[model samples]
Target: MGIRMIHHICIQTEKYTESLDFYTRILGFEVVSETANFHNREYNTWLKIGDFMIELQTPKAGDKFNVWSSLNGGPVHMGFLVDSVEEEYERIVELGYKDFKVKNGKIVYEVEGESLFKIKAPEGTEIEIRDTDIK
Candidate 1:
């Protein structure tokens, strides 16, 4: 029950190259570190945006072994803070990201009872975007 703080957020994607580019180029996060996964013979990289860190990992290939990420309870989904939720929503759609909606049970944004909206990245990852509210 000692869930005090989040150390890092991990994302597992088969399209590691695409995901990395989306985070670094599209979202403008910087690569702080990277290393090789000796066990799986893949690449592991870390990107930073402000105070948050994201770990991008690739799944093992040619495998018949039971290897899994520690984040197995759920797949990768990330949230991004924007200056304007509506504006970002439009921009994301214009950039070809689809499935954008705001009807769900999730973090409540401090904008007159409106919660956050959701969208999908290129590799089918859920990305939630909300206005720039600390809460």
Candidate 2:
């Protein structure tokens, strides 16, 4: 088998609506698809950011959980490529999301990247924005 770029990333959120808004409004992602699994009693929402997609899932009551926790420092977070890291950094700051900082002279929106500021999303998930070709 050959390796390829990431097709998508799945994140579990107790606050589905808040996560959705954070991705769509704050991070400038759009919803591509959504489905509800009756048998599993879960909801999945797919969000598109550039060429990559993120799957937000909500587990049913009493279901065995396997996603990020709201309390335990959250998930590993996700990275997003931007045309200009500085531009995105300023935009994120104006949007009023908390926990914004710069590191290594690069604008980081999350702790996942080695450079710049880290931006924390509403669901406690961080979104790291970097200057790279995401296409």
What Cα-based lDDT does every candidate model obtain?
0.68, 0.71
> For residues 22-116, what per-residue lDDT tens digits would candidate 2 score against the true structure?
88988888999888883465678889977888888876767666444436654565667677877877787787765654455544433444334
- Candidate 2's TM-score: 0.70
Q: Give residue 62's error in model 1 in angstroms.
A: 2.1
TM-score of each: 0.66, 0.70
Q: Quick one: best lDDT, which candidate?
A: 2
Q: Whole-model lDDT, candidate 1?
A: 0.68
- Candidate 2: segments with Cα more than 4 A from true spot: 37-39, 63-75, 101-115, 132-135
Count clashing residue pairs per candidate. 0, 12
